[model samples]
Target: MTLAKSSELGITHLPDHTELPESDGTFVKNFQEHPQSLLLTDSITDVLQQLHPDHQFAIGQDCGIYWRLTEPPEKGAEAPDWFYVPNVPPMLNGKFRRSYVLWQEYVAPLIVLEFVSGDGSEERDKTPLTGKFWVYEQAIRVPFYGIYEFSKASVEVYHLVDGKYQLLPANERGHYSIPPMGVELGIWQGQYKNMTAPWLRWWDTQGNLLLSSDEKSQQLTSQLEEVSSQLEQEQEKAERLAEKLRQMGIDPDQL
Candidate 1:
């Protein structure tokens, strides 16, 4: 389906490129208490980059998503913990994107992820016209909305159906399928970025875990070591056979 342009959506006059607020000072935050949020975001971005080497997609971490061009940044924006916009250049013009302005981009995010911090009410707030859930569901109408609570080690996925968000049930492996991304979202228990905890991770449609760069490197290293060890054992067995043949009064190299 063709998405409506900003002018078609009642935003007749596009704001001057220079007048758009790129950074509303919302990107900067103290992550000491919630460092996992950064780790999860970075890991997902890295994995997707590996998964789709040729595609250029925008992945934002704690960056403002300005849904309305007519409204000011303060009233029209929401900064998700992580968001993915497919088929878009990671940069705007030639510079890094400071904020995702929906009207200018003409594409809403395919999926938005909110890592539950503090009391977790803000992530699930459903107050109309004000709540994060409401904005993503009604205003932006994102396809998939995920709420991950690290404290409970749970993930809640909501799919937009009939202009409302419907909770989705996990599959047999306890993952929510995200068709647009061609991956599944699930909680993984492991150490990432040196922190041992449950992390929201992505899996292939076949249920294979998508690894970060470091994890991929480690996996390759492990496979190489296993092959080397098998080679060494074979070499030792060949030497043993040669020694036994020599003891039997025959030149081992003749055959």
Candidate 2:
């Protein structure tokens, strides 16, 4: 919403996160949106932590980023499916931020991602002031903007260069490099939370898929199981050797 205003008296003060409306009274376009947002956030958290050792970073999921003042505050904001702003505290004054106010915090989001629910028109709209593309590139000036279409199993990434959006070409491994975080953005076909589909995911610059916390745990468990099985096999082999030595009339323990 607009700043704390005074109509009777000529006075106005930019409202902080607390004074803004958190939502725009709109329904999430589809069911996949929530899980998709979480998948992106869950997978890249470690990278973000390492990038911001002070833990001064914020990731917003379907959260509003207010760029300008408007009659109905939500109109002035664009709520991306996912976004990451670097070097900002996860909270403001020990309280969760209801919305990201750009005027209050001059730092722009490093990247903003939009998941396509329809024909992808909205995500690519470049109409000045109101269009999502224009708002992100011109107003918010998010350095990296991605439009992902799960049904198509593809994403189009744009990098802002020289005050214009430039389509970024994928590297040899078909991923877009985000140098700031030492990671790449790409689509992966896999199972997440029991759903098998093409998901928008992150990878290291070297083309290693970034695993979520659950995936990491599962990997550790598998490794432990393998190690235990090897130990058992080695123990059995040693016992067999001892028996053979005894049969040969040699004290197995003496060796």
**Which candidate achieves the best TM-score against the true structure?**
2
- Candidate 2: TM-score? 0.94
Query: In candidate 2, what residue range of length 10 has the lowest lDDT sum?
Result: 1-10
TM-score of 1: 0.84
Residues 1-255, candidate 2: write the lDDT tens digits. 223344433437777889989999988568788888888999999888898889999999988999877767788899998999999989989999999999888899999999998899999999988899999999888999999998899999999999899999999999999888899999899899879899999999879999988899999999999999999999999999999999999999998
* Candidate 1 lDDT by residue in tens digits, 1-255: 122356554665655334567566543344432555555555567556775686678888777787664345346678887888887887889888777877688788989988776677898888876699998998888999999887899899999999999999999999999986778989899887778878788888899987776787899999999999999999999999999999999898899
- Please report how far candidate 1 places residue 117 from its true position, in Å: 1.1
* Local distance difference test scores for all models: 0.78, 0.90
Q: Deviation in angstroms for 44 in model 2?
A: 1.3
**Leading candidate by lDDT:** 2
TM-score of each: 0.84, 0.94
